[model samples]
Target: MIALKRLQILLPFVGIAVLLAVWSLTVWARIVDPVLLPSPVSTFRAMWIGMTSGKLGVDFLKTVERTIYSTAIAAIIAIPFGILLGSSEKVYRSVEFVIDFFRSTPASAMFPLFLVLFGVGDRTKISVAAFGAALVILFNVAYGVMNARKTRILAARVMGASRLRILWDVMLLESLPQTFVGLRNGVSLALVIVVVAEMFIGSTDGLGQSVFEAQQLFNMPDMYAAIFAAGALGYGLNLLFLTIERRFVHWSGK
Candidate 1:
């Protein structure tokens, strides 16, 4: 049992090791052009240097800043609005189609519209990202609240809890898991939108800009480094949210 548990703990690393091996083999065997796909060492070295002593670090931070700002704005707007809608089925139904429609629209497609509205500034990128994220969060939160266990809500009411109290306690608590799910999804989408916007939105410094510049220059190593940095950021953000959920929403899976 102990051995099985230990194996499970280390299981995720197996994929990493296999991927690295395959990558290294491909590079060594010249299966792909070296100019196109750098060795893992070359890629990591570029990543280390760019992050430590070059402009890549600044660009990475800028992307982080934009993603965080957008996600925060999304959560702030969506959470309360979601609660209101969730608490009233009629209100939720009234605008469900509208919410889903906009949510279905690609954020990239909205860039031109937002650029027209806010111009080619940080405002346009951030606001467009926020708009996309807000719909995802709002949809999840409303469903979470609406799906709160009826038994618990009824029990609260039977115990003489006011509507406000039941909402604050029972419904909100029940909604936390799904809310976190929304947050995670929203942040990911926000990051993607921010990166794409940075690439094309007249930005001077950002991971996306770095990637674009590197690709244009045919600097494959540096481009890979930037790509890995962006991936790391997304993974780190998701892990952070998951950790917070595990701490605060301990009963989430149960």
Candidate 2:
């Protein structure tokens, strides 16, 4: 079992190595133009230079900040609203169409609307991300609450628990696993929207800005570097949520 666990840990690294090997071979064999597809070494070099020069660092931090802000805003708005809606079928039904409509709409499509409402500033970018993330979070959180065991709720009520107490102690805890799922999805969506916003909405610094600038200049290595940075950022954020879920939602599976 220990060996199996070790293999599981090493398998991802092995897969990554194999991918890198194939990528390197393609570049070495000139299957693709180096100008369009830089070698892994060149991309790594570019990333290192960007990091050392502090450009990537600054952009990375900006992207992280925007993601955090958007996610926080989404959570703040989603949790309570989701609970309220989930607690009452009437409330959920009343706004279900609206929620589904917005959720189905592409977040990028709403960028123009947000820009019109909030202007071409961080507000617009942040708001778009928050809006998209909130819907996803709300959907998951409400489902979590609605799926809470009826028997537990009945037990609580039979013990004379107040509505608020039942909500706070029972429903909230029951929903945490699904809420974390929402949070993980929400954060990913937030990052995607933020990067797209920075790319199109005139940002001074961000991973998206770096990528856009690099592409415009035909700096393939730099663009690849920024792309890798974005991927790493996404992986890191997901890992963080997974860690938090494991710690907090201890009873989730059982």
Candidate 3:
């Protein structure tokens, strides 16, 4: 298992290494202009300078903090509503129309309203991220609830379990994996959207702001570095989420 897992992890890195090598060769051959496509060395130098000067490090932390805070807030609010709606047929049916409507709305479209209502600030940025992320969680939680094993539920009822008891002991427990999946998706989306929202809203510092500044100054390498860092964060956090999910859901054991 350990060997297989190690191989699985290494495979992607190997592919990335090959791609980078090709990129380096292509740049060296002048197939891609340095200005159009920066060499890895140049990008790395820019990253190193940004980090050593504390620009990249600071913006990275700020972006991470905002994403974490907003995602957590969204999860806190979404879980309850999901539970309530999921536990009842009537509630689910009634709210499904509204939930579907909001969920279908693009998060970016809501940014203007958020800016007007909250003004350009951390609060508005975080709120937009939280609200956008919450919608995804809400739908997933509802999905988990609606799709829960009906046989298990029927058996519980036949065994004289009360609705509340069935919910706590069966419904919620059974739906945890799906719920976690929702939270994971929400966290990822929150990270992406929050950064975009922060770039224009009122953020003083963040990876998004770094990207914006880089564009304004025509610092392509710096912009690429920040973008690369964002990709790394997303990939890293996704792996972290899988680890946590595996720990909690032992049925998913290797």
Q: Which candidate gets the maximum lDDT versus the true structure?
A: 1
lDDT order, best first, reads 1, 2, 3
User: Cα lDDT of all candidates, in order?
Assistant: 0.96, 0.94, 0.86
lDDT (10s digit) by residue, model 2, range 65-142: 999999999999999999999888788989999999999999999988898899989999999999999999999999
lDDT of 1 by residue, 40-89 (tens): 99999999999999999999999999999999999999999999899888
lDDT score, candidate 2: 0.94
TM-score against native, each model: 0.96, 0.95, 0.91
**In what order do the candidates fall by TM-score, top score first?**
1, 2, 3
**Candidate 1 RMSD to the real structure:** 1.3
> Per-residue lDDT for 13-114 in model 3, tens only?
897899899989998999976776788888888888887785998998888888898899999999889988888868899888888898788788899998
Clash pairs detected, candidate 2: none
